[model samples]
Target chain A: MATPYHLKIVTPERTVFDGPVTYIIVRSTEGEIGILAHHMQIITPLVPHIITVYPEAGNVEQFTIGGGFLEVGNDTTVVLADSAERASEIDVARAQLARQRALETIAQAKPDIDLIRAKRALQRAENRLKLAGHSAGGMTSA
Target chain B: MAAGGLKEVDRRIKSVKNTQQITRAMKMVAAAKLRKAELRAKKARDYFEQIQAVTRRAVSKGGAQKLVAPRTVQRKGFVIITSARGLAGPYNANVLRQAVAKMQEVGGKNAAAFAIGRKGRDYLAHRNIPILQEFLGVGDDPTLHQAQAIAREILQQYLGGEVDEVWLTYTKFINPLTHEVRTLRVLPVEEPPAEESGAERSYVFEPDPETVFNDLLPRYVEVVIFSALLESKASEHGARMTAMDSASKNADELIRQMILMRNRLRQAAITREIAELVSGAEALE
Candidate 1:
C-alpha cells in the first residue's frame, strides 16, 4: 500500500483543511489531475471548480475552489486556492443570488467592467449553487 | 482630620475606579477588533500561497535570477507596521522593543522607520529614531490604498539606492491568546526553488521583467503591509484583553483595600467620641 500523504488546502481566509488525506483531485488551468502518494512534483495554476479529497476509504472532503495555484511534492499536496468553501457550509440561496448578479454583470457588457472577472464569478457561484442546491433557479419569471 | 482622611481615600478610590472602567472598555474594543483582524488575515492567505508556488518553481526550476542578484540580499530598508491606538499594557512596548532588537542585530547602516500607528510614532519619535514617513488615522479598517501609499515611499527609497533591502516587523496573531512578533524581509525580490531540477518553464513578461517587477514588487509589498496591519490589529486586541483583565483585577484589590481602610477609620472615630463623652460625664459627677 502507498504511504498516506499530507494534504493542505489553504485559502486567503484560512487553512481550510490540513491533515493526512488518502487521495486528491485538482482542476488546474490546464485540466484535472489526480494525485496520490509519491506523485511527481508539479506546480500549476488552479481553475475554478470542485476539488475532492478522499481522507479515508469512503469519507470525502469536497470544496468549491476559485482560481489559484497548487503544488504536489514529497507526498504532500498543498493547494493554495484563491478561495474555497466546503459544500455543507455554503448558503444555497445566497449563492444563487450571487450567481444571478454575476450573470447580469456579464450580460450588461459594460465597456469598462472586467467581464472576465464577472464571468468567473458567475461560474464559481453557479458551481456552489449546484453543490448547495436551492429553490431559486432558472425561474426568470419569478 | 478624620473627615479629611476619609475624603482623600474616597478620591483615590474613585480615580482608580475610573481608570479601571477605561481599561475595561478598551479591552472589549480590542477583542472586537481582533475578531475582524483575524478574519482579514485569514483572507489574505491565498494570494501569498500563489506567490509561494511561483517562488518554489522559480528558485527550484532553472531560472536566470541568481541569489546574488539585487533581487535577493539588498539587506537594508524600512519596516512599516502599525501598533494599537490605546495602551492597555505592553503591546506597543513589545513592538518597539522587538523592532529595535532586530535593527540592532542587523548592525550596519540602520534602516529608517515608517510608522503607522499613533503608539509606534510617539514612542519612536520621542527616542529620536529616524522616521522615513509617519501615517496616522489608519482607523480600524485599513485599505489597500493606505498600504499602497506606504509601499510606494519604501520602494522609492530602495530603487534610489538609499537602502539595499527592506524589512517589515509586526506582531503576527497566532491565536486569540497569543501573538508572535515576526520580522519579514520585504524588498529585493526573493524567489523559491523550482518545481523540479531541470524543469524549465518559460514565463513571458508582457512589457518587460523590469517593468513588471517594478509594479509587482510594490503591490506585493503593499499586500504584505496590509496583512501586517491586520495581524497587528488582532495582536493588539489580544494584548489589550490580557492587560485589561489584569487591570480590572488590580482595581478590585485596590477597592477591597480602600474599603478596609475606610472601615477602620470609622471605627477609630467612633471610639474617640465615646471616650470623650465618658470623660465629660465623670468630670460632671
Candidate 2:
C-alpha cells in the first residue's frame, strides 16, 4: 500500500471522519478529484456529493457532504463541509420520501412555488439516496 | 388538633416534594443538553481550526486591500448572546453585565447593540441602548442558519462603515462546574502569529487567492459567531443544571426541617392527651 495520509472531514456540527487513508476521492467544484499521500498543496471548493475513502487497514468508508472547502497540505487533507454524515447514517426511506415530495412539487411547477428550492431539495435527497447505496438515476457520479 | 396539624404539614411537604421533583427533572434535562452541546462544540473545533488555517494562509499571501484592515475605533457594534429563557442562575446576568460594561467603555452612544437572545434584548432595551438588530427565540439548539444571519448583519454594518469595530459577548464554557463570560473582538480580523505562518506550502489558488480570501472572510466571521453560540448554549445548560441541582437540594432541606417540626408537634400533642387520660383515671379511683 502507498504511504497513508491524514484525512479529516469536518462539518459545522462535528467531525464526521478522521483517519489515515491511502486513497480519497472527493467531488470538487470542477469534478471528482482523487488524492494520495504527498499530494501537492491545493485548495478548492467542493460540491454536494459522496466522498469515498480507502483506509490503510479497514473497509472503505463513504460520506455524504454538502458544499464547502477542501484543503490539501503536507501529509494532511482536510474537508470542511457545511454538513456531512456517514453513508451508513443516511435513512433510505426518508430520502425516498423527500425525493418523492420534491418531484411532485417540481412537476406542479406553480409560479408561487420555489423551483430552486425544490431542485435543491431533490438534489439533497438524491445525494442521500446515492450515499445509502440506492440507485438514484440521472445524477452525476462521484 | 394533632391530626389537623399533621395534615397541614403533609400538604406543605407534598408541595415541597413537587417542587423538588420539578427541579430535579429540569436539572436532568439540562445535564443531557449540556452533554450534547459540549460534544457539538468539541466537534466544531476541528472544522473551525481547519477554516482558520486556510484563511490564515490566504490572508498572509494576499495584498493589503484584500486584508481585513482595522480602522480607527469610533462606533462599535456589540453582538451580545445570552439565554433566551432565564432560569440559568447568573448565566444571562453575567453576560449582559459584561456586555453593558463593554458598551459603556466604548461610549454608550457609539455602541450599536445586536442582541441574539431575549434576555440580551430585554437588558439593552431597559438600558435604552440603540439596537441595531434583535433576534429572539434562539433556543438551546442554535442552527448554522441563525449564525449566518447574525454574521451577515454584523458584516454588513462593518463593511458599510456603520461600526469601526465589532465585539462578541458570550459565555465561554470551560467545564460543567465553571463558565466565564467573556468578550471577543471579531471584526477587522486579527492576524495569526508569525510562528504559525511557516506551515503553508506553495498552494495553488483556483480563482486567485485574493478573491478566495475575500469570500472566506465572511465565512470565518460566521464560524466565529457559530462557535460563540455553541459555547454560550453549553454554558447556559451547565449553569441551569447547577442552579436546579441546588434548588432541589434546598427543597429537600426545607422538607426535612418541616417534617422534624411536624413530628415534634405530634409528640407534644400525644403527651398532653396521655397526661389528661391519667388524671381522669386517678379522679375516678
Candidate 3:
C-alpha cells in the first residue's frame, strides 16, 4: 500500500478538509490529474470540478471546488480553492436553482450581468449537482 | 426657577426610550455580524498564510526578482479600504486618516486612489484627491471577485507605468475589542526574506518556474487584497458593535436620570396642589 500524503483543502471561508489521503484526483486547468505518494512537486491552477479523496481507512470523500491553485511539494498537497463544499454538504435543490438562474442570466446577457461570471456560476453549480447526485445512485462514473 | 412640566418630561423620556431601543437593536445586529466576520477573517488568513508559503518559496528561488526590481516611484496609488456606512465609529476614519496622510506626504496631485468603500471614496473626493476607481456596496462581506476587480485595476496601473508604486491601507482586526490601521507596500512587489536558507526543496515546474510565478504573482496580489478586505470588514463590525453598545448604555443612563428628575418634579407639583387644597379649606372655614 502506498504511503498517505497530507492533503489540505482550504477556502476563503474555512478549511474544508485536512487529513492524510492515499490518493487525490483533481480537475486542473490542464486536465484531470491524479496524485499519489511521491508525486512530482508542481503547481497548477484548477477549474471548477469535483475532487475525490481516498483516505487511509474511511470511505472515499468528494468535494465540489471552484477555481483556485494547487501546489504539490514535499509530500504535501495544498489546494487553495476560491470556494469549496463537501459533497455531503451540498444542497441539490439549491444547486439546481443556482444553475437555472445562471442560465437565465447568461441568456439575458445584460450589460450589468457578466456573461463569463454567469457561465462560471453555472459550471460551479453543475459541479455541485453532479457531486451531490453521484453518491445517491451508486454509479462511480468518472 | 420653575420646574419642568410633567408632560414635557414624559415626552422626553419616551423619545429617549425609543432611541435606546434602536441602539440596542443595532448592537444586537452588529454583534451577530461581528461573529461571522471574525470567523471569515480568520479563515481568510489561512488562505493568505498558504499563499505566503508559496510566495516565499518562489521568492527564495529568485522567481519574483523580475517583478520586484525597484524603479523610481514618480506616482503612487493608494488602495483605501473602509466601511460603506458610518455607524462603524472610527473604523473608517482611522483607515482614511493613514491613507490621506500618505497621500499628502507624496503630494495629493501625484497620488491616485482606489476606494473600496463609499466612505473612503467620499472622503477622498472632498479632499481633492483624485480617485482612480471607486467600489461601493461591497458591504460587510466582500467577495473574491470584488477583490480581484480592485486588484486588477491597481495591477494594470502599476504595470502600465501610470503608478510607480501602490500602497494598501486597511484596518487590521486584532480582536473583537481592538483593531489597528496598517499600510502595506503593494507595488513593485518586494521579495520577502526567506525564513530558512537551507530548508528549500527542489520544486519541479510543470510549465517553467517563471511562468508559474507570473501567474502566481497576480493571484498573490489578489489574495493579499482579499484578506485585507476581510480584516477591514471584521474590524468595522467590531467597531460598530462597541459603539452601539456604548450608545445603548448611555441612553440607559439618560433615561434613568430623566426618570428621577421627572419623579422629583411630580412630587413638587403634588406638594403644591396639596397646600393649595388645605388653604382653600381653611379659607372656607
Candidate 4:
C-alpha cells in the first residue's frame, strides 16, 4: 500500500475535506498531474477541474473545484479553491437550471450582458453536471 | 393628582418595556448573524494565510517585480468598507473617520474613494469627496464574487493610471466586544520582509515563473479583498451585537427605574387616602 499523506481542500467559504489520502490527481494549468506521499514541493495554479482523491486502496472520491491554487508542502498538500463541491453534495437540478440560464443568456447576447461571465457560468454548471453524472447536455460547441 | 401621576408612570414603564422588547429582539438577531460571520471569517482566514505565504514565497524568489515595485504617489484610491444600515454603534463611523483622516493625509484632491456600502458612500458624498464607484446592498454576508468584482475595479484603476496608490479601509474583528478600524495599502503589492525570506524552499512554478507570477498577482489581490470583506463583515456584526446588547441593557435599567417609581407613587397615594379617611372619622367623633 502507498503511504498516506495529509491533504486538505479549502475554499473561501469552508474547508471541503481534510484527511489522510494516499494519492490525489488534479489538472493543474500545466497539465494533469498526480501526487503521492513525500512528493517534491511545488506550487501551481489550477483550472476548473475535478480533483480525484484516494484515501485508501479501492476507495476513490472526487470533487469539482473552481479555479484556485495548489501547494504541496512538506507535511500537507492544500488545495485552495474559490469554490468546491463534493460529487455527492452537488445539486443536479440547480446545475441544470444554471446551465439553461447561461445558455439562454449567451443566445440572446445582450449588450449589457457580460459574455465572459456567462461563459464561465456555463463552464462551472457543466463541470458540476458532469461530476453529478449528467451528460452536460452536449453543448460543448458553444 | 396622585392617581394621574401614577398613571403617567405606568404609561412610561409600558413604553420602555416595549422598547426593551425591540432592542432584545435586535440583539438576538445580531448575535445569530455574528456567529455565522465569525465562523466564515475563521475559515477564510486559513485560506488567506496560506495564499499570503505562497505569494510571499514567490515574491522572495524574484517574481512579478513590476507589480510589486512601488511607484510615486499621484492619485490615491481608497476602498472603504462599511455597512448598509445603522444601529451598529460606531461601526461605520469609526471606519469612515479613519478613512477620511487617511485621505486628508494623502491630500484631499489626490484621494478618491470606492465606497463598498451605502453608509460609506453617503459619508464620503456628504464630505464632498469624489467617489469613483459605489457598491450597495452587499448585505450581512459577502460573497466571493462580490470581492472579485471589487478587485477587478481596483486593479483597472491602478493599471489604467487613474490611481497611483490603492488602500483598503475597514474594521478589523478582534472579538465580539472588541474591534478597530484599519487602513492598509493594497496596490503595488508590498514585498515580504527580508528576515522571513530565509530558509525558504525553492519550488517549481508551473508553466514558467513569469506566467504563474502574473496570474498569481491579481489572484493575490482578490484574496486580500475577499478576506478583508469577511473581516469587515464579522466586525460589523460584532459591533451591532454589542451595540444592541447595551441598548437592551439600558432599556432594562430604564424599565426597572420606572417600575420602582410607579410602585412608590402607588404606596404614597394609598397612605395619603388612608390618613384622610382616619382624620375625617376622628373629626366626626
Better of 1 and 3 by DockQ: 3
The sequence of per-residue lDDT tens digits that candidate 2 reaches over residues B73-140 is: 78999999988888888889899889999888864568889999998899889988889999888887
DockQ values for all predictions? 0.14, 0.60, 0.51, 0.62
Candidate 2 lDDT score at position B28: 100
Specify the CAPRI tier of model 2.
medium
Please tell me which model should have the higher TM-score, number 3 or number 4.
4
lDDT of 1 by residue, A83-126 (tens): 68988888787787888888788778875547777877877887
For candidate 1, give the lDDT of residue A15: 80
- Per prediction, the TM-score for chain B is 0.85, 0.88, 0.90, 0.90
RMSD of model 4 against the true structure: 3.2
lDDT of 3 by residue, B28-88 (tens): 9999999999988998887888887776666666554445666887888888998888887
**Higher-DockQ candidate of 3 and 4:** 4
Give the runs in model 2 whose Cα sits over 4 Å from its true position: A30-32, A93-124, A139-142, B1-14, B64-67, B106-108, B199-202, B264-285
Task: Report the poorest 10 consecutive residues by lDDT, candidate 1 chain A.
Answer: A133-142
> Pairs clashing in candidate 3?
none
Better TM-score candidate (1, 2): 2
Cα TM-score of candidate 1: 0.70
